[model samples]
Target chain A: MELFMPLFIAVVLVFGLIKKVPIFDAFTDGARDGIKTMLSIAPTLVGLIVAVDMLKASGATDMLCGFISPAAKQLGFPEELVPMILLRPVSGGGSTALLTNIYKTCGPDSFAGICASILAGSTETTFYAIAVYYGSVGIKKVRHTLLAALSADFTAAVMAVVCAKLLIKI
Target chain B: MMNLIFAAMIIIAVVCACVTGKGSELAQGVIDGAAESIQLLITMSGMMLLWSGIMEIARRGGFTAIIGRLLSPVLRRLFKKLPKDSKALCCISMNVSANLLGLGNAATPFGISAMKELKKLSPHSDKASDEMVLFVLINTASIQIMPTMVGTLRQIYGSREPFAILPGVWISSVCALAVGLTIAKLFCKNGGS
Candidate 1:
């Protein structure tokens, strides 16, 4: 499965070769368009990065963790994951940092470690994706996109905890 | 709504930083964040260019159409509002394929292009169409077969089998996708009413 990506790329390239497509010219054209798209999206990306950075640096996750850890423990979720839960939806890198920390402290086979790993895999940084994808198109009236995405994130987080406990044998 | 979230995040950051006496850290983080964003953009540009070029080849060689044919049934159900032969659906088909394969970086170009194509069909130019909303929701809740990013991270942290949680990730992601799509469908219907 690890080789799946490289194999997929090879197959695509081989098929393109067989089709007699001008692969180089096509690639450059597409690349140029990608750069143009990047330029158009730069401002929104930068703004989000700064805000997320500031939010992380403010220790807001820690504060939230303090408030929610007890309730989380009561509900069978690991107390250590409160900070991760608070940050996961808003910032992928932040939750990743927390995840690495969890892995380091508890070992990868520990309940907290498996749960954190599963959560990272199963969900996305909802706000970041919404902002980048929707903002790129200049869509302002996001309507229910946020609500639906957040609900998904919420579901993933809960499932991660349950699945890790039930299946991970930790 | 975007503005509100942005402002709220900034305000919360500022107030929390000031109260916690981490003013200097906050100041430093701003610079680091700006630099990271630029770095991320550069990396994204390179990846996007490569994939875009590959996709261009695929499009020219009729490979995208093959992919479209394979994914059309699922895409049709998800984006019923789109015409049967719409280019937007083709773009979406490619995007969903990339996402499922855990090639999210490659998927974004197709996703952005899909939105652009969808935008052309919208009666309200500034507002998202129902199809667009559903697309965004699906993308956010993307179900990955490999979940390679997380697996790689677990490997770095010395897991015996980094992909050991694959089943858990697959099950949870599928669950999230289902929950998200259901909510999106309900919202879409209410909007129609």
Candidate 2:
């Protein structure tokens, strides 16, 4: 991973050089630009983090688990998957925490099942994505976007489960 | 409350923007703080540029085109109402491309672009058309080939190959996307309101 990081950076450096722009200047500017953007997003991310932390701490996740686990089993998803599917629409970081919990309980090479579960967690929160992205862009035409995004998330969650169960052997 | 979000953001930005009442020499520390973040900024920019390069190579080298062509058969049936060269098609392609590389950050712009394109074909602006619904379905459940983020994490932790989970990743993504599309089609016909 450390090797990949530098290699990835090298690829960018080479590409930037080929494009004939100043390297150090661009790098500094790019860094400065990143800091500015991070500052812009710092509040939202912090608020989201706090909200999710509170939600999880308050047992909202457990409530969701109770609500969704039976349905998930009916849908052919495992009980463990319920948390990920439930948590993803609510919080990516929270889902990450849940995934760590799963890994600790089940182990990583619990193979295809674990793999599939994690994939679902890595997916975007369709509803939240629409809310944040559209909200950022000042969009009012949200009725369709919301439906569209939610539909996508809902479908992806199902597919992630099925593929994990049947397609990959380990 | 909706527009108030922007107002709140502006206020926050302004508050963060203002800082100094201290003496001039002491104030240098305030301005100096922004400089430290430049290193991380450079790291991020470099990461993004690499991913863009991967996407460029993929698109420019016909990887995306081949993938598109491979997908065209099913996409044709699934999205029959949309034109062959529609902007929605382009956006879907872009979204899929970004997703494939595990660049969710990069995919957002493409997803929004596709939505805008889909909106043009929408009837009432309040309702998603059949095509819009299907487009969202497939794009949402879009199969992932390489799981970059996961792979990177595994690699960091010293997994043997790091990407050994590729087969499982591909299978789950394909199955998920397929079932999602089928359900969307069914819902579009009988259940949409």
Candidate 3:
């Protein structure tokens, strides 16, 4: 894994040389574009990060989790995973912290821990991806992106529990 | 839609804070969150620049086109509106390859570049095209061959087999991707614009 990026870079540069491409000029131009992309995405990142932090600090996520616990349980989802599932789409850091907490409390090989691991491993941080990808291009109307992404996340969450039960022994 | 979601988050946070008497924590969170964003940007800039530079060379060397050609059969079904040889298809293939390898940092730059290419082909400058929505949907599903980070974390937490959840991860991810694509296709059919 560590060698992949270095190897990829070496191959690209070697290929560029063989093709007689001005590699240095291309690199600088692309880096300059990267800086502009960063600038364009900054504000959206700030707004999203702050909103997520506020939600965490305000205990609203916990409160929301509590409200959804029964429904989550009814769906055969672990009640303990309610908060992780809720935060997974919105905040990567938040869900990760929750995953560690689950590992601590439930043990890594426990049903809840296995489910949390699968949940974390399988799903992407939807809101962050949506914000960065669309925000960079200044696209205001995302149309069905959020709905589609969240639907996928929801499926991942449910399937995580289902697969954990069906696959893991303990 | 973005406006509503963002506004709702802030409003909910403030309301919850007022009721919970966590104003001080909320205030602190704002400062920390702002600082974290800058910190994240600084960390990402290096990877973004490096990958962007490498990808530029790859593009110039026609490597990205070769990759596009290799992945065209699979990508064509997902992005029917895009032409076979579209630049966006090349970038999207690169991004997908990076994501599958669990190279999250490298994937971001490629995905952003793909988004830009899609933007160029979009009739509406300010709205997402169907292809753009599908691209984002595929990314957010994040199909990976291995859950390396989760495995490492499990190892640190004392799991006997850190990669024991691999089957579960594969099953859930494939299911998620299938569901997300089906929903995206249905939505596009109902009202793409």
Candidate 4:
């Protein structure tokens, strides 16, 4: 499947060019715009990373871990997952830092660490995704979409824990 | 200074954890893991740029419009509150298509574009409407066919079978898409009425 990605891209480009089309110009324009978009997101990404480090520095991460430890145990998740979940509303990198903390503690091959991996991949950062996407377009009505996204996140988290306990064991 | 402080704390954690044999593996794992995560981000970013370029090309080439036309009927059924002719629909379709193909980093811009269109049609100034909410829900629950993030993790972990997750992914995503849309529709209808 991975092997097909390059092939697929080649096909798209080839198809575009063969159609008597302007491939080079279109691609350059897209790249130019992509750089603009990347610039917009870069600062936010840095700030998010820095703030996450600060939270860890302030011992906030430990407090979060302490609080979520019981739930983690009860839910059969790694205690480090608390910070992971808490950071979901804020930043992906923030949660990644927490997840690293988990894999470090639980051992990367453990169910706990794997579960954190699942959670990271499975759930969308609902509020953050909405805020960034909507803010880009100046949209306001879709605030209600958070409910649905969060619902899915809630389901995914529960399923992730349950599946980790069941499937990872298998 | 803060990054320096965090680094020190992590190093301390690694030593303490390793010495105590208390989750030291994870702390040490973090030390070993940093370069990989950074590398993964760089790789993912490249993919992102490539995808964004592809999307831009599609839009410029009118391929996106073609896709929108092909998907209009199906999208209309899924998104009833949103008008077929609206810019929101175009954005929504691009966003959904990007996610479905496991191109989320590329999807962000389209999603933003969609919302801009949706906001115009929306009567409210501060709040999202029913259609916007539904769009967000569907995008969030986006039945990802490729699960790029997971694939990346598997690759980083040296999984010889990274694509094996496809079955589980298809299963979970289909379930989430169906149920999420159903519940959102039900909730909106119930709530709005």
Candidate 5:
């Protein structure tokens, strides 16, 4: 897996050389464009990240998790994973913190810990993706992207627990 | 829509903080969050530049085109709105392949480039087209073949088999992608864009 990247780079560069492409000039041009892309999305990143951080710091995430625990339990979702699932689609840092917290409280091989790992692995930060991708192009009206992404995240969260229970012995 | 969501998040956080007596932490979060984003950008910039450079070479050398052609059978069904030979298709294919390889640092550059091409196809410069929304949906669904970060974290936490949850991860990822695509297609069919 580690060698894939180096090998891919070598192949691309070698291919570029064979094709008579000015690799250095092409690289610099793309890097310049990359800088521009970064600058354009910087404001969006700041706003979204700050909002997510504030939500976490305000203790609302935990409170919401508590509020949703009963319904989540009824739906067969593990109560211990409510917070991680809630934060998964919004904040990567927040969810990772919750995952480690689970590891600390529950052994890493335990159901909750394994479920947390699977959930974290299978879900992307939807809000961050939407913010950066649309923000880069200055797209304001995202329409149904949020709804679809969140639906997928919810599915992934459910499937994580289901798969963990079916696959893991403990 | 985004404006409202952003405003609502800030408003809810402030109100919740005031009610919960977490005003200080909230203030610190706001300050630190902004700084942390910049820190993240700095860390990511190097990879972003390298991947962008590599992608540029690949595109110029016709490698991306080759990939686009190979993936076109699958990509064509997903991005029905795009022309067969659209530049966006090539970039999107590269982005998706990078993601599948778990090269997240490499994926972002290709994704951003794909978004640029999609934007060119958008009738309104500021509104997201259906294809753009679908592309974002695919990315946010977590399609990596291996969850390397999770495995590493599991190993750090002293798991006997760090990658033992691979089956679970794969099942969940496939489910997420399937559901996300179905929902996106349904929404697009209703002319939600």
Candidate 6:
């Protein structure tokens, strides 16, 4: 994973030099565009961050987790993972913190811990991605993107738990 | 739609906080969340700038186009609406490759650029095109050849074999991507944008 970026850069630079492309100028132009894109998405990012953080901080997440724990358990999801699963699609950072908490409280080898890690690895933060991507492209009407993304997240979560149960002994 | 979700979340949080007597905590959270967002923006800006730069060089050097050509056969099947040699295909190919490699920092710029490129083909710029929705779905459930973030987190938390879930990651991601694409295809009934 660490090698991917450096290797990618080296290959691009070498190829650019070989092709005599104006690598420096192209780089600067793209960089400028990158900053502009970031600026464009800032408002959306801030809104999402505030919403998610407020939800988590208000203890609403914990309340929701408590409400879902029984059903989650009946469905074979580890009770400890309710919070992570809930937050997984909303906020990447919130889910990561929850994953870390699970690992710290329950040993990383535990079923819940393993499942949480896999869940975190497998899904994207759907709402965050939608906001940023659509905002960047100036698309106001997002038709089926949200539905598709959340369905994917649900699939990943279920698969993550099932796979963890099958693969991890503990 | 986005506005509705945001409003619902804020209302839920505020109501829940009042009921739970956590108004002060909620106030602190709002400030902290805003600050964290800025920090995230700065960090992401640096990463995006570097990757956008490198990928631009790749674009100029014909490497991205080469990737686009190689993946064109498969991509054409998925994105029939796009021309075989469309610039959006190049960006999409690069974005998918970056995603598979677990290069999240590098992937966003390409993904954003791909959306922008795809927008140019959309008859209704305000509404997402079929191709755009498909692209977004695939990206949201991107297949991970390397689950770098999870592996690192596991290692940090003292898991002996951080990559033990590699098979699980691959399986779940593939499943998610497959289901996501199928659902997205259902939504794109008109076909070809």
Question: Per-candidate interface C-alpha RMSD?
Answer: 6.0, 10.6, 7.2, 6.1, 6.9, 6.2
lDDT of 5 by residue, B53-76 (tens): 776787688764575467779988
lDDT of 3 at B33: 76
Off by over 4 Å in 2: A1-80, A104-106, A111-118, A129-170, B1-62, B157-161, B189-193
DockQ of each: 0.47, 0.10, 0.46, 0.26, 0.47, 0.46
Question: Which is superior by lDDT, 2 or 3?
Answer: 3
Number of the top candidate by lDDT? 3
Score residue A134 of candidate 4 by CA lDDT: 64
Candidate numbers sorted by DockQ from highest down: 5, 1, 6, 3, 4, 2
Candidate 5 pairs with clashing backbones: none
lDDT of 1 at B144: 71
Better candidate by lDDT, 1 or 5: 5
- Arranged by TM-score with the best first, the candidates are 1, 6, 5, 3, 4, 2
Segments of candidate 1 deviating more than 4 angstroms: A1-67, B1-68, B190-193
Clashing pairs in model 3? none
Off by over 4 Å in 4: A1-70, A100-110, A133-143, A162-170, B1-71, B83-87, B102-109, B173-180, B189-193
Per-candidate TM-score against the hidden true structure? 0.69, 0.58, 0.66, 0.66, 0.66, 0.68
**In candidate 1, how many Å is residue B7 off?**
14
- Report the alpha-carbon TM-score of model 6 versus the true structure: 0.68
Q: Model 1's chain B TM-score?
A: 0.65
Q: Which is better, 3 or 5, measured by lDDT?
A: 3
> Per-residue lDDT tens digits of candidate 4, residues B6-71?
465456554555455556345444444545445545655664566566655555555655665677
| Clash counts for all predictions | 1, 2, 0, 7, 0, 0
> Which whole-number lDDT from 0 to 100 does residue B86 have in model 2?
79
Taking the tens digit of each residue's C-alpha lDDT, what string does model 1 give over B1-193? 5577678878999999999999998998799878976876675566555655665666667764575578789889878778888889888888887776555666889999999999899988788888998899888885776565566556666877777787888888889888998888888845541
The DockQ score of candidate 1 comes to 0.47
Candidate 3 residue-wise lDDT, B96-178, digit = tens: 87676565666889899999999999889999988998999888886876565576567667877777788789899999998
* Regions of model 6 farther than 4 Å from truth: A1-66, B1-70, B191-193
Q: Give the CAPRI rating of model 1.
A: acceptable
* Residue A6 error, candidate 3, Å: 20
Cα lDDT tens digits, model 6, B1-193, are: 5567678889999999999999999999899878976776675577667766776677678664565467668888998878877889888998877676555666789999999999998889799988888888877785766565566567666877777787788898889888888888887867433
Candidate 5 positional error at A147, Å: 0.6
Docking class of 2: incorrect
